[model samples]
Target: MTDVEPSTEITGNMQQLIAAKAEELFNLCDTEQKGFIIKKDMQRLRDELGVEPEQLEDVFDSLDIDHNGYLTLEEFTSGFGMFLGDQIDDGNANEQEMIEHNPNDKEEQQLFHDTLEALGAKDLYDDEETIMGLWMKLRENDPVLLRQFEQFIGKITQEIRRSKLDHRSIEAALHSKSSVHESEIKKLYDEMEQQIKAEKAKVLAQEKLKERELREQMDRELRLKEQQLSELTKKQSDLEMKLLRLNLNESETKSENERLQKGLKNLANI
Candidate 1:
């Protein structure tokens, strides 16, 4: 006999709905939260619910809001409600439903990058501890339901990859723009440096020429002053010799007058 499908069971491949549920499930399963189960490993959820693995298949059907086959926080939380919430109150149905993510959501786009980074960082998907831990945490008891969740995860991962490709394209465009701007700035800077150096050289050459002219003027003035000094010394020597000759002539005249006076006295006495 074919296995009777439960009314509560839902299809796992709905991209719009079930994938979101898987992420939430993983968050709850994250080590920090003891109450959460990781769908990557559904045994944990099974253990938490204390239910057989087959029972989890109904989780997808019962929680699907849009029938898009993807589960949102509400659906997954509804799944978790069986195991984790000790509180009697239903937390926030309307708010949970509003959290539905379409492929175009920017935040979800960011989440795709983050998830890839996370997977790269931990290598958790490849390691056995985390995988087994995931199993123990969300799937051990409900093996069949775990398969459905896995189906949903595969669907989301494909979307995530596509999101990453689009993101890369945009990133490449931005990098190209940045490179162009940097090149322009460098060219401008180089031109300015060259102009400044040329101006400085011109100023230096002009200053040197002015100094040469000033030095030439100074030398010419010194030569003129030296020639004047030499002429003045020769004139002073000639004047000194003329004064000596005039003194000698005056002495001779005085001696002659004395002699004439003596002769006159002698005649008178005779």
Candidate 2:
């Protein structure tokens, strides 16, 4: 809820309980014997929770720390207390209170609200529920933008933790730091765009070259076939001409033989 380190907050026994519960749920959901639970596998749970598909998807994504679409037992175990432990009616009112508490200082809270506003989240607050709801909305509407914001927040959180600055210094530091980060991000984005364009152009050129080569190969094949066909046609014509000449010679020989036979017959009669 507060995005604090679970190791710092969850007791050893609590962690064990969460791990056991996570294993039970993971086993129950993984009915297909795939050793992992996918979105479809969590349908019954989703229906039971009465949450929308997008919300369920967000939960799943959170549990799936590797973003690999499948939640393994280890991943589920590690993330269950952070994400799904609230769903269970553990009768721990204190845990709920802890989750709802605003861990951020006033400056940090203002920065959080301002960042949410910049990201188009309305009616923002420092409370966990409001922030989470907005996150879900952001994930559904513009996941790419949400991811960018998450990166920025992660960086800022790290900086704040490392420096341990007073509340007053935080606002000025955040503004200055955020400005520098935004500039770096914009420059990186432009570079990535240029790289993408170059890669696309290279791919298009390769495709076009391949297409041209294929066309030329087909043309060469066609010409080879034509050449072979012409040779065959000439051979056929030559054979036909030779057969006609043999036929004419045979006719001439037969006529001469007939005339000779007639002469022989006349001589015999004489």
Candidate 3:
């Protein structure tokens, strides 16, 4: 009997970590040769593609979909999450869970929303995450326990292929619910955006129009008050002039009566 030394060739575990850490994975992934690493050698790829080397970055930037700073294995296989878009059990929850769960029956089927929330990465997985998806992710990342304790899971996965159980109904339900939720959120956001924008515009327009209208109304009122005050002032001046003329006429008449009485008394004495 020959004994073999254990080597870390990534066996079956660590695939998720590899997929997640795309830059590091690409750095360590086995290349056809050793030429892909150097930045200066990118000109060779440019030449092979028949584009100018200076335009290489622009071309890659255009092709880069996830914008993760590098081409991941999925990108290399198809393009940007395309491999995972159609995961064998993407829409089936129950059947996918049955095939990918721990075969030893020791671990319960992990729910992504519950488990990822516990790990604080809940939003990162989205609804596409399911039992098989998480199992595949865990098996690809955790190295130490992948060979033995989690080994039987791969065996149970084969049962799904042979089983007669169906999951089309569940997939339809999940997709329908997701679609409705997404539409609701999108509609709410759009409506709020439009209403806020319209309210702001209306308030600004009203303020501008009302400011000048109010100013003009105030000016008209002030002019009318000034005209009334001027008319009252002219009437008061006319009354004062009439009172002065009457006083002068009364003084002249009193002087004439006194002289006439003195003249009559002198004539009688004569």
lDDT of each: 0.51, 0.63, 0.48
**Model 2 TM-score, 2 decimals:** 0.37
Q: For residues 10-116, write the lDDT of model 1, one tens digit per residue.
A: 21212224345545555544545544333334545555444565555455454454566554444565554433211113323321221221124456446444544
- lDDT rank, highest first? 2, 1, 3
Per-residue lDDT of candidate 2, residues 68-180 (tens digit): 78988877766665563232334255344434544545664676566655544425223334344334444545665456435434443444445555665788888989999
Top-lDDT candidate index: 2
Give the Cα RMSD of candidate 2.
Answer: 26.6
Q: Tell me the TM-score of each prediction against the true structure.
A: 0.38, 0.37, 0.32
Looking at candidate 1, the ten consecutive residues that score lowest on lDDT are: 6-15
In candidate 3, how many Å is residue 253 off? 1.7
After superposition, the stretches of candidate 1 with alpha carbons farther than 4 Å from their true spots are: 1-166, 255-270
Candidate 3 structure quality by residue, lDDT tens digits, 1-270: 113211223212223332443333234432544423332333445422344665556544543666755554445333212222312222234234423443423243344334444444434422222333445444555433233212223322323333323465567778899999999999999999999999999999999999999999999999999999999999999988888888887887888888889999999999
